[model samples]
Target: MDTTHRKKNEQNNHPRKGITEFDSNRATLRGKNIFPPFYVKTTVPLQEALKNGEVRNNTHLLVIERNAQILALLTQQMNYHHVAQGEIAGEPWMVSL
Candidate 1:
């Protein structure tokens, strides 16, 4: 994932009120989390939820990767916004909302 846009937004200290489709792909959902393995496997639908006002701050969504048995929870962080990058075995990726 490219941090160019994330960094730019971070510099301005702007909180994303809604997630556009363009930004949906950034979530990088794994296929196993979705209904079927052949599905889009993208968080775009979740982004649409935010865009459509279906969720609010402090709202968290959990995704379970059946294959890997990994649990991913996505939530927005009102403060301390920063993306910590790195991968650890058996550890799921965590991003601020």
Candidate 2:
């Protein structure tokens, strides 16, 4: 058999590891907002916050603070493949991370 063909076959037979690598390097806590914080009405519109740098992709845990008081704890899983196979019912801005 040809060397190139043998290599291709080997690659095809190997089990791919995508999630393991992503989980290892992915962020686990909210560092800082890239943009100035602004009050927005809807959570679904929050994608603009991420894009415009108001909220950061680096933020794994979100805290809603108002007037120096802690409001809530946001425990979120921002994995890339979290919603892989489902079609979104509404037109929410998607962050294709």
Candidate 3:
């Protein structure tokens, strides 16, 4: 059988399936408790969180919510800046999407 067929069989027979090799490492990280939920905010500025020690440079995900809906997922490498007045400023960069 082809790889797709094999994967489908695995999904039918196993409780956990559709997990690609790349997801395996992320699973390990979760299993080992290596990563924790980073800062989550809506109106609260990320820079304020950083200055208040609620977030660090290694913070990967910024869960932003607006009007009870998730506005965006600010992933790692997302360009951002903190102003002198402790304001977070920046827009998500588009890469030929």
Indicate which candidate wins on lDDT: 1
lDDT, candidates in the order shown: 0.47, 0.43, 0.46
Models sorted by lDDT, best on top: 1, 3, 2
Ranking by TM-score: 3, 1, 2
lDDT of 3 by residue, 1-97 (tens): 9999999888799955555556555443434423333332334456776799876778776444333443333454233321111112343322210
After superposition, which runs of candidate 2 have C-alpha atoms over 4 Å from their true positions? Answer: 17-21, 24-97
TM-scores, in order shown? 0.22, 0.20, 0.25
lDDT of 2 by residue, 18-81 (tens): 3345554556655754433332223434566668885576766444444443322223433322
lDDT over C-alpha atoms for residue 86 of model 3? 14
Provide the RMSD of all predictions against the true structure, rounded to 1 decimal: 19.2, 14.8, 13.0
User: Which digits, one per residue and each the tens of the lDDT, describe model 1 over residues 1-97?
Assistant: 4799888777677565454547665678675533211212334455666788876555865454543544344433222333322233435454332
Could you tell me which 10 consecutive residues in candidate 2 have the lowest summed lDDT? 80-89
Number of the top candidate by TM-score? 3
Report how far residue 68 has shifted in candidate 1, in Å.
Answer: 8.4
After aligning candidate 3 to the native by TM-score, how far in Å is the CA of 14 from where it should be? 10
